[model samples]
Target: MSQTIHINRVGLVALALSLCANAQSPQERSPIGAVLGTSTPVEELSTKASPAVVHIEVSSYRTSADDGDEIKNQTLTKRQGSGSGVIVDPDGYIITAFHVVKGARRIRVELDRRVRANSPAGELLNGKRRSSFEARIIGVSKEADVAVLKIEAQGLPTIAFSESNNLKQGQLVAALGSPEGLRNSLSLGVVSSVEQQIEPDDSLVYVQTDVALAAGSSGGPLVDIQGGMVGINVFSLTQRGREEGLGFAVPSPMVRFVYGQIRHYGFVPRPYFGVDVQGITPTLASALGLPTDSGVIVAGVGPGSLAQNEGLQAGDVLVSLDGMPLQNVPQLTWLLLHKHIGDRTRLEIQRKSSKIVLDASLISEPSDPEGSIATIDIEENLVAKLGIVGSARKHGTAGPSPTASGPGVLVVARLRESDTRAELAAGDVICSVNSVPITSVAQLRATIESFKPGDAIALQLERKGKLMYMAFEMD
Candidate 1:
């Protein structure tokens, strides 16, 4: 089973204050006048920012007939998801994190109250509003983890973009999102740092802030005091795999890049290199007799790839791209995705005893150039976690069972001595794992990884119209 992470929404202010008051007695309470000074009022910002924020929900369906299962039936299931989005146009286009509505079959939008509907109080509140709308996925950038959505609603309020280039460290900032299930939540903090690169895969310039964002805050806007959006909150710092208060956001430049592509072309055209690279450390470079702190070492180039055709070979050190110094692997990857195909780029590198320059034309994904740009390779680690590889059944499903069809993931390759292989036959169709429906390879792995070795695992399989239970040790 694979590991899973989820976000939670924060409660409303009145409820939070009530909870705090309940924790204390009358004597422990502070004077109301003194408490005002301790709090920085954000009501004005909230009133303006809430209109630009929205909630998203999605649903999907799967059919057993598609999986080749004997059941030959169909099942409909709806998945609900919540994330923050910024209205980018008066015509109702929205921008959000890609993971928010990935694989969504249906999407629904909820705008601030009082915009088109009466406030919950119904007192003809002038500033309070709530409106419901429908939305659809317009485009997605898997490499950049951004998605654009559009709505039919007109005259929508939009947020203004500020120059992230001028953002300074230690400046005050606000994070607005639906944290822990509460909508239109706001938190205050200061910019901790700027342009701090933390991950090799995170090449988009970022602004690190000390905002107290909790779960369900991804895709929220990080705004300056003037209420202009400077960045989009994406993720938080995790030490030893645990989340900390320090959060990071995508700077306005990358946001504008993705937004422009989606607005003009309806999709982001990511440049593909068809090659994999490994970082070169100073010590390793010295030992290899190469200039220290210069270039990456090509590990593998895909067959018929742009890099392979351009004479990019393994063990070569990549020093620069388009004459700009390449400090790390992420910088190179960013350059590749930063433009469209037909854009020419240059690579400077060292091969063994000599330096050379390679000029190349960027290309789209070979098979589906306009599809998702995420590189696809068999994840051995992810497969090993499942202990079973499934092939789409000739007339059945290849995924885990109990999915309205029956149990067991179709067996493509079963690891030797695996528990499932011992109790169930190779060709048998598994319907359930201890009564849980098996859906995809991901679902199978996630379930298995949730248990430890020596844990009891059970399966229900169908072989020739007879259902049987096979029990085994997880290890």
Candidate 2:
């Protein structure tokens, strides 16, 4: 689960369009339209972009539908799911929605039929596309609902990202993906809204469209008429049980930002400012008798965090960060993600009728902890139910914190690809089970076996120098 973010540089290819076309006589036009029959923009776009719009196949485990007792006792079953991914690199980097591949034991990508026809191997046997490649996860951002994957190939056809903020309402868009296992399906629509929140409290936004999204269309690309990537298709509000014509996509700007972070760090890292801020409201401003009716008011500051260390505290109004004005939480959240570890950023604060500035370095996660790792070759070290092998924590072996002193069982390897409920990594140290400290492999196994099927289990683990809890139901 530990990863370092990096980037595989990609080139942006913009398809140029004619702003105006000359008038044509009735005789010159075809029945639908000469443009439709001839060099249609969408036709050209599909030609250019479809090669990179790949069909993804995933295999994962899901609980069965059964009675309470039967469900608890039954083993998990495998599920086959299909989605679409857009290749973004010539070296075979593909981007798709995280949900499409979440908890997947295996992932495979099939290139477009046209690409398969020209297979370098010169033949298709077993009815398989020679271009089909197994994909390895580069990284995933669950919050943003995006995942970057890589296939072993060279000189792949790729779709480049476009500026999503430049998109306006009513702009023509095309949806490309495999819907119902039919690869290279295309649908036309218009931009319904540039940005919208699915939930009132959630900061993540989507580009709304009236696209004809059917089942199995998730993770596809919503491209402009010229074929530039505008967003990755997430979900439709529905054709419902009735047609609502509602669909949404994660904007490309956010995708580009997240894609870069995942490539670099294996995940998106929201930089820590240590100060929590709330948006100023007219009512609150009146109640507090504050100067400005709109601004970010600091609610609290984390102790020992860089902000607290830099002299930030509660009740202070955050006027701006690195000179940009801040007014709302979403804006603040979006801005903070741009800061990386070791980067120094300036914060403008309005405190007690005076403005002051403080510079602080971003460090939400610490450096990797150097420690001894256990070997899983021995049978006695296996924690079979958890799908991991373990060993006792030894003297001088620890996480980043010097204060993390205790007996714990260290994970050696993860054996079950299907049992990823805990996402336990090799270097992780299982410290406790339901608050009871674990000191050996047998103890950990015994503790898990003690629980009944469907019983809740919470494990405290130290991973990559940080302590965190992963909870799941015993099965």
The C-alpha stretches of model 2 lying farther than 4 A from their native spots are 1-38, 61-78, 117-129, 198-201, 275-300, 314-317, 350-356, 365-403, 406-429, 432-475
**Mind giving the per-residue lDDT tens digits that candidate 2 earns over 197-282?**
66423557799987777667889999997899999998887533664778899999999998998788876886767566677778
Model 1: worst 10 consecutive residues (lDDT sum): 369-378
Candidate 1: list runs displaced more than 4 Å: 1-44, 60-78, 117-130, 238-243, 283-289, 303-306, 366-475
Give lDDT tens digits, candidate 1, residues 293-387.
54467778766666888989877888888898887776776677676788777888788878899986776753221122111112321245444
- Candidate 2: deviation at residue 39, Å? 4.0
Q: How well does candidate 1 match the true structure in TM-score terms?
A: 0.62
Clashes of 1: 39
